[model samples]
Target: MNGLIGKKIGMTSVYDSTGKSVACTVIEAGPCVVTQVKTEQTDGYTALQLAYGDTKAKNTSKPLQGHFEKANTEPKHKLVEFRDFSIVEKAIGEIIKVDDVFNEGDMVHAVGVTKGKGFQGVVKRYGFAGVGGATHGQHNRQRAPGSMGASSYPSRVFKGKRLPGRTGGDNVKVKNLKVLKVFADQNLILIKGAIPGHKGAYVILEKK
Candidate 1:
C-alpha cells in the first residue's frame, strides 16, 4: 500500500456544503525522501524506504548517518518502509509530497500510538462493571477486579486476562477516514474524524 508518514496537527471543525460542522484532523503529510528502494531481485521483496523529519548530525547514530549520506540527504528523525509500496519511478533521494499521492475525498487509514493513560483499574481500563451496590460488605471493592479464576483448580491467573496494569500507549489504527482537503503548497491534508496519537505524534496514513 502507498502511504506517507505524517504528524498530527490536532483537530478542527469545518463547515461543510450543507453548513453542517464536520470535525477533522489536520496533518503535515510528508515531503519525505526516498532513502532506499527495495526490489524483488535484490531484497526478495518490494518496498520503499522513506525518511522524514530532519535532525542534526550530532543527534544521529553512525549507521543512520551513513544511510542518509548514501541517499544524499540530511539526517532524518523518522524512517519507515512501505512493503509492496506503489508510486512514481522515484529514485533515491527523491521527495514525495502529500499532493503526489492523496487528494480530497480519498479514504485512508491512519495508524499511530494512542495517548498514554498510565496505570489504571478495570473500570477505567477495561470498562468492567465492578461489584455494584454497597451490599455483602462491599465497601471499597467497587472498582476492584472480581474473581479471576478458580482458586484450587486454576491457581494461577490465566494469561490474556483483562486486568488493568497499564492503559493506552498502544498502536491503534483508525480506518476509512475521508480526506476532506489537501494542501499541496503547505504539505498538509485534512481528514474527517479523530485519529490516534497526541499532537505532533507521527502517524502513518495508508491509502485505502
Candidate 2:
C-alpha cells in the first residue's frame, strides 16, 4: 500500500497554479492486483506482493501460473513486494488503484532502471573534459581518459577508476519527487521533473 507498480508513460509539461510551466513525467500506476500477502506468523515478515500488467499464460512458467491461479488473477508481467505495507487488511487478489495511495502535491520516490548507453567514454559517462585539445599533435585523444596512473609508482590502473566501459542501465531511486497531478480515472500520475528509466519501463512509486 505504500507503493505501486507502474510503467513510465513518457514525459510532458503542465502549468502550475502560478502559471509556471513545469516538466512532468507521466506514469501509468496501478490497478495492480495483490498476488500474495505475507504475514509475520507465516513468512516471518509482513509484506504485500502486487502484480501489474497482463501477460499471456502460455509464456508464463508452471510455478508462476499456479501462483497466479492461487490468487485468482491472470498472469502478470511485473510483481513487486512492498515490505511492511501500509494496508495490511488487503487480501490476495484485491485490486489497488493509483488513487488509493497517491494524491496531488504528495512527495513520492521513483525507483527504476536507467537507460543503457553501452561502451561510452569518460566524457559522456563521468563528465570528464577528456584529454587536451587537438593542438600540438594530439590526435585521437580528445575523448580519451588521460593519465590512468603514474608511470612507475603504481604502474597499473587502480581499482574503481572512473574510466568508462558501460554506462547507465542502473537501478536508480529518485527521491522526493512531487506528485504534480493524479488522474485516477485514467490511472496516470504526473510527477514533477524526470524519473529514471526509458519509456514503457517499469517503475516503483513509493510514498515519501
Best by lDDT: 2
List runs of model 1 lying over 4 Å from the truth: none
**For residues 64-140, could you state the per-residue lDDT of candidate 2 as single tens digits?**
99999999999999999999998989999899999999999899999999999998989999999878889999999
Q: Ten residues in a row with the worst lDDT in model 1?
A: 81-90
lDDT of 1 at 126: 90
lDDT by residue (tens digit), candidate 1, 1-208: 8999999999998889999999999999999999999998899988899999988999999999999999999999999888888783689999999998899999999999999999999999999999787898999888889999998878999899999888999999988999999999999999999999999999999999
The candidate maximizing TM-score is 2
C-alpha lDDT score of every prediction, in listed order: 0.93, 0.94
Candidate 2 deviant stretches above 4 angstroms? none
Return the clash pairs for model 2, or none.
none
For each candidate, what TM-score against the reference?
A: 0.93, 0.96
